[model samples]
Target: MGLLFILLLGVAIHWASAAKLGVVQTEGGQVKGKNVKVSLLFRSVDVFKGVPFADVPGMWEKPKPHPGWDGVMRADTYRDRCLQVTLLQKKTRGSEDCLYLNIFVPQGRKLSTNLPVMVYLYGGAFLLGASNDMSFLGVSLYDGKEMADRGGVIVVTVNYRVGPLGFLSSGDARLPGNYALWDQHAAISWVRRNIAGFGGNPDNITLFGQSAGAASVSFQMLSPHSKGLFRRAISQGGVALSPWALQKNPMALTKKIAMKVGCWRMNEDVMIKCLKMSDPVKLTMAGKIDVLLILGKGTVMDLIEFSPVIDGDFIPDEPSKLFHNAAEFDFMAGVNSMDGHIFAGVDVPSINSKTANTTVKSVRGLLAGLTKEKGGAAVESAFSVYSSNWGSHPDPAVIKKTVADIETDFLFLVPTQIALQLHANNASGARTFSYLFSMKTRIPGFPSWVQAEHAEELQYLFGKPFSMPLIYFPRHRDLSKYMIAYWTNFARTGDPSIGESSVPAVWPAFTENRRVYLDINHKISKTSVSSDLRSYYVSYWTETYSLLPSTRQTGVLRAGDLSPPRGRPESSARET
Candidate 1:
């Protein structure tokens, strides 16, 4: 009798565990997932972690769909991250076999079908990141439980290759890089085909990402290979138009890596074969891999060591040339008000430098390296625009913001503005919404003076306030709720405000003439926005800097307009 009671207890425990988990059949086979509870409202979501969407890829080869599994593949755990170095450059972790996707489905009595699907791609300058919830800084970087629950959509996060393993290309057929992009393509294709089994609408999938992921989404919007794959697209903080998005003279960078891996040879086939078999760790650590001995030195092309290549197929032309037309899909993109903080902060003496000189000389040395022959002239011209209003002895905070403003405009602000304008002009009627995320972050690392530094919007957009209620104020929760509504509403009907009264104001569609853009902050309203939208800075970069002889000689794009300031008027900004 005692043994029978013990056996009954064991069965009961197993039943309870099963009740908290869910099973779904995929094209590959059956898989089990964890049932997670989210939000104060207490909704359950089945989160399938580390489900293989594509098989392990060979070096420089496109990915293939995962072979059908034999039986119920236990997918309750996150997969290994793709190989990458940490942001601090203090540590390294991950593996070559890291191509997996995590899917989150809102649990219900019957099948949860016909729900909109959102597939996310993370960004780390195309160098590092993972799809696991506990990925970045040991926090929930890619958790979709709350998003799936709150938005009533199927949320899928993907793990694509980064670093040399993902982006090193030979600039030819031998090794046309962008293996990471292909991995993204495979993951999306798999989702389009198999998401119905997970109770999602395969037809209404929205692809969105931040940083490199955003650039990847923009690339897909132009690539023929990605046609008919997604209905809506969103990019945050990065795009193909950014200086670091495409790897110019990739052949030179590839050859450098080849030599580092001891794979150099006269024959391209032999060189590639050796690289395939070389140690991945050694290849990744090709030391200072961010930009070393390369032909495109002293130019914007060398900003990032490895990135997507225009291999004639995936990206047939330069991104600027291709922006004349785009996919027939609604689009949304924005940048943090201080999006350049991370990049420009490294050069400036930081908040600690109380009496530092915020002059052209401080930035001239760096611009010389990036702008090459025209570095000095470029600095003078840009300084005239960027530091126009600074009274030479500006406060350190103001100085820091001014420095960050240059990077913000060059790397993110202007590029995003141009992208929105191009998409607006290209679209027949497809809508494009642009915004500037000015909401400050609650995360403590950033100096209080910094407003909406890069990726600050992610936490609010992903419902972080809902998860860590104690750490956030009531205002954060309210802001997060409205953001989710706008994002999900856009995914569902291509409009952020369609009967959603929670939104503070009507988001006007950006056009070439009006150039309307939302300034998202404590008060979210059209009345708070500028109609001309960075008109002065637009003229400074596009007209003054772009037409300069330096820009022409450097072979860089006409990145700036005639506006004295990068995006705002001299009276409003530090730059003239």
Candidate 2:
């Protein structure tokens, strides 16, 4: 009788555990996720991996809502990643039919309070990345399990198209660009319509991304199609104003790819058809070859090869003009301290200030490769400003630092500041926040001086396992909690600091007048924006004139108008 009683108790406990980690009914059908043990604090969380967000009928076409299954779908493991070259410069296992998303719901949440949704878009310069592939960056960046469990929010990771298959344009309507952005839009729409069933508040969704993904967030804010899908946004280390975010001459690059793939001789329609039929591997290889050629030339083209174009439907106008008409919602945008390291090649040679003329010449050569004929004057003016800032001939370290500064401002900082300013200026009580991630990380093989390289904050925010000893980097673990708090809190409410966790400092809203940004280090603090840097670079980019094609001939500054700023109005500009 005692043995039978003990057996019955054990069976009851097993059934109770099963009920806690059981199936959920989504809009399409029922899904059974795996019971995952996420870290120490939050033991068991149900993670639905590789859930199809959209249906891919073919390559180079817009994605549609997924035709979900009839019966229960087992979502235990991640699906295939979208095809792209890996960080190691080798091809990995992926497919063109890859428009899936991962949904993670925290366990033990009360039924009354529905959790907010946070969608993550990974970044690889629009060339490579995956939602579930640990070979990419998840081991030390973007762990969804920890984010969902600890933050008490539904975290989603999405996979979208990239490379030539995603951004090919033919100057006409035969093959338009921005198919990748369209994929993102579809994914967001899916989340909005179906996330409620997964214990998420679809109305209170936040879109957050880094690098190329960050640029996409900025673009979505500007585009009319994505309005009202998500309530808040966070762009890290990239923005629409960044030179690499928008492709200058998409057709020219498309032609180069076609020529390499032996489809150049065909008519526009035939060429596109041939491209569709061609091997995905060949297309990816061709793109990589051309990109290497562009990078090897030591030109500004090193930053990007293929990216979102100004398609009339999706990205109707110049990014600056579109920023004025963006949806009124809370925004948080920022960059890392060492973001320039992304643009500066791995083997960046120290620029010796002793060779002032050589330094100027090299800089000119790099800028000249990326601009149009009319843009020469802009490049020359930019050179003059940099030379003045560096004081003709200074120390080698000074030259190196100045170069990194210019790269940072041109690629990330200036653009990010301008975006924040625009969002703040055109406000309908929707607050704007800016931050600078300056925490020093100890990623293996990198120098100790490395202060948060691009996307380093992702590791802490998503709870990647530690690369270094926790004893040595205890503050980073603490910081991870703080960042997740800020992000998930912002998703729940508009303000990040008004969330669940205890933050180290009070984060203030960004105002154009005060120009205050939260500096997130070991100890967070609100500090003054860089007056000299902002005045020099941001003013030049935002206040002077736009580089985009203008609708009004008189309002747009011509190439001849780029004169010296001291005696005249505005003269200098930066590069890609």
Candidate 3:
């Protein structure tokens, strides 16, 4: 009788263990996950589902009363991506309730081990992206079992509101603008609260993003609300302090959007009610009507109008001003070699009298607003230098390219360099490392002329070149290993160059004097490709401008306006 009782008890225990470690069904499908054998916590594979982060009471304005998940969500499949205004026909289905996140971990892992956590923010010009995109699927990025065997880490990808819904600012108290930024905060909070259930260490989170996502990471660093949420950050292309990036001025832009959507005439309460009653698809379409107008306008515009707000609650001040004052955290920021060339078009000659005058006035206004103190002479000197440098170029195309390059550097690279310099100078013990991705890939339809274009490093970092049409070379795996190791190592320790595990080259530290950059090419070396250009930009920016509040200044002459003079500038047009 005693022997029989012992056998029965052992069998019951084994069955209970197996049942505890069974699979959990999610909205998309079933994923095998585990439940703690000793502890009562359930480490399920799919824990989060499509959860709304904010409530858009009205269609034309910012969100209100952020929303939270009501129950344990089954996050087996990716939620539908946000609604996009597609020029090309593509399947699209998602709700405004699409602020969602996904967590991936080893099939069966214990929570006792505090694994490093990587929270990914996707990139689509802060307008389009989702956690469910195949490109963002992290299982292949970090092989769970392999990582666990070596050293465990958790990967979390989150989706935030985008486009008009997230960025359109009303600059009104009724509309707390930058709802998308709010969504990101909510997602981070969720990770802090629930990532532990998946064997992730919330305390050691590494925030990383590419392109617009990278810019978002920089924004988080500046945000007081995001303090302590992440220990480390990596920005691929987008840096927060760029002159051309978005600034938060919600009221004006939100009012414009409201007017465009036919709700501007109504009171706030009435507008909100009308927007809520309208069809979501109609609102989405109406929102996209201003894409062309807002194309060149980036986060820098937000500095004056609407992007990420400087609300006392979320963001306190401009990231540039903030970083310049003091460094609160560590960062890894960089830009691609040919970032400007990818988006470049055929160049044009000097602007005509009308265009030139408009351009001058616009430039003057921007400089005046940025530099609240009188610095007109300095601004003119800077412009004269730019004009002379541009004029010296023999080829009109080359001159245009240089202008575009300046714009790109001003809006992206310079800000990144500033942030790195600030962090290196101010941070207590934390270090700042910088790199320039110059490795050009040989992919079909990759415009052989444009080498190492914008967002090119994404393939190498992700260890998969899906966007690349074809892989002609065999060194892809080598590059992938090198990049992944460097990135993962950074995530492990705040330093990216802690050790040379599997990477081929030795990445050096970025110092004020040395100014070393990891030149990623066939033979990755530390060198400066455009020292002259870099020097010119640094000098011009430093010598010019005053820091002041940004304001609305329109009628700026853009490159797009300079189409070849109609009918050779002398022919009369036919009446319609």
Candidate 4:
């Protein structure tokens, strides 16, 4: 009995020693994480959740780096998300002090591994999102554990301010918005400074995102302030050139939202001070005006009202004009098969409720607003083009598809094409690669006719959340595997297919004449589609308007630039 007791005590001591091995020493303090089994046969991966990279003091202020802590901080669970409105106009669980980031590292790996890092920024139309496990609409998204485990690379998902709290602008430094973008910059800076402690190569960080997050990535690539923070970037389904990506006459919108909150319009400074003292919830809810304009009836023009703006310091010029500077970094941009389906889905209400003339007029108003009167003739020309293609259909269903197709080309495909052309023509280093995800998503609740709606590619790259169905398993698992390989390979080396793995196809660089893109379905195929329709639209819009200049540097153009009361001669050029 005495011998057996001694043996049991020895085993207990050994087990306790093994448990302490998961502790990682960060600059802030020592944090202990747990090993999570992400795959059946593979070993567990270590995840440290809710690690504070910045200290956010309430709303409307910039984030500060977290001061070092005194002792061990147990990073075992997620912290509250940053304050933002949720789906269905409900306020979700989050706080102003929510500037945390989650990190996933390979378990039992030595410090010498020095894995490449991929940091993700979630997309929510610049409104709703968090760093923890949550699905946007039906697309289950935002987990780095699977990426870290499967790809053998470190993954970090960050949280920043969203909604009006992140992007409200007084058009000056006094109450300059884009605090959300600064929060992301702070995260990147923190990673650059401290990522080496977690077995990640700080020099090789890659920034990638979808939707508004993708737009943010584009801004980062263009901003001189964000230079050297990331080595490469991947922007999916969004670009800075999209009219919806930038707000016009932002101060007017700011004053309007302030009025809704009972703060009478005064000078910009006084109004900003009044807003700082108002109820934070009321301030956040007041932003629903931008929402109504964006997602309500009429055109899909306002669907992205609260997005990133040119704040002089961060974004100097329109991204299209700034491509010469952006050509320095390696870039990859892509789109889905049915990128227009989202706009089409939104158009159902407008078509059902409004008359055809009203719909056409609403679209024309959107075109004039988006193109600043220069594209008026082009808009008239486009209506004819669509009518001829769609058989001049007066039917609402035909009209809806036509409108969706036009918007798809206008909002996503054409802008991407222009960006790729600029980058390919001017980039100093790596050649740009583009892709088209054409696979029909098996995720439940997605319409069968919808081929890869906006962000379905997220599931293929990062495994779906457990709450969602296992739609991509067994059959499409290889696609996910190759995608992980492709992404991580790009992070390690500038080229995706240059690594040791046997990638199925050789992805060619995009060029003006070729316009080649990889079509990812059951099998990956390299092909180029006829671009006659797209080329015509692109030529008209580019010829009509110059790239929009920064509002801070140029002041609000809409307030002064609109056709002057029908009496004065119009300026030769207008800012759009």
Q: Which candidate is the best by lDDT?
A: 1
Of candidates 3 and 1, the better by lDDT? 1
CA lDDT, every model vs. true structure:
0.75, 0.70, 0.53, 0.67
- Summarize candidate 4's per-residue lDDT along 1-576 as a digit string, tens digits: 999998788655444332223677877778877666544333456778889998765567788768868778888788888777767766544688888888888653233257788888888788878876464564326767667766777899999888778898877787678888899898988888888888889988888888788878877777888767878888888777665677656787688778989875667778888988887777777775344554443455555668777778777766666767677678888777667667655644453333443266655544444444343554565566555544444655555545555666667766666677677777887567777667775655543344667787887788553223354455476677667777777777877777544566776666545555666655653432222224444453343233333223321112211111121111110000
lDDT of 1 by residue, 310-408 (tens): 989888887766764464778899888888877665554553244554555666644555455465677677766666666767665666677777777
Off by over 4 Å in 4: 1-21, 40-42, 108-112, 133-140, 289-297, 350-376, 391-400, 443-449, 465-470, 511-514, 526-537, 543-576
The candidate that achieves the highest TM-score relative to the unseen native structure:
1
Identify the runs in model 1 with alpha carbons over 4 angstroms from their true place. Answer: 1-21, 40-42, 87-91, 108-110, 133-139, 266-270, 287-303, 350-352, 355-359, 392-396, 443-448, 499-501, 550-556, 559-576
> 544, model 4: CA deviation in Å?
6.6
118-160, model 2: which lDDT tens digit per residue?
Answer: 8988888888778865544324255587888777788999998
Tell me the RMSD of model 4 versus the true structure.
8.1
What stretches of model 2 exceed 4 Å from their correct place?
1-21, 39-43, 88-92, 109-113, 134-140, 289-292, 295-300, 346-348, 351-380, 387-393, 444-450, 465-472, 526-533, 543-576
Query: How do all models score by TM-score?
Result: 0.89, 0.85, 0.70, 0.83
Candidate 2 least-lDDT 10 residues: 567-576
Error of 1 at 123 (Å): 0.6
**Residue 495, candidate 2: alpha-carbon lDDT:** 87
Model 2 has how many clashing residue pairs?
0
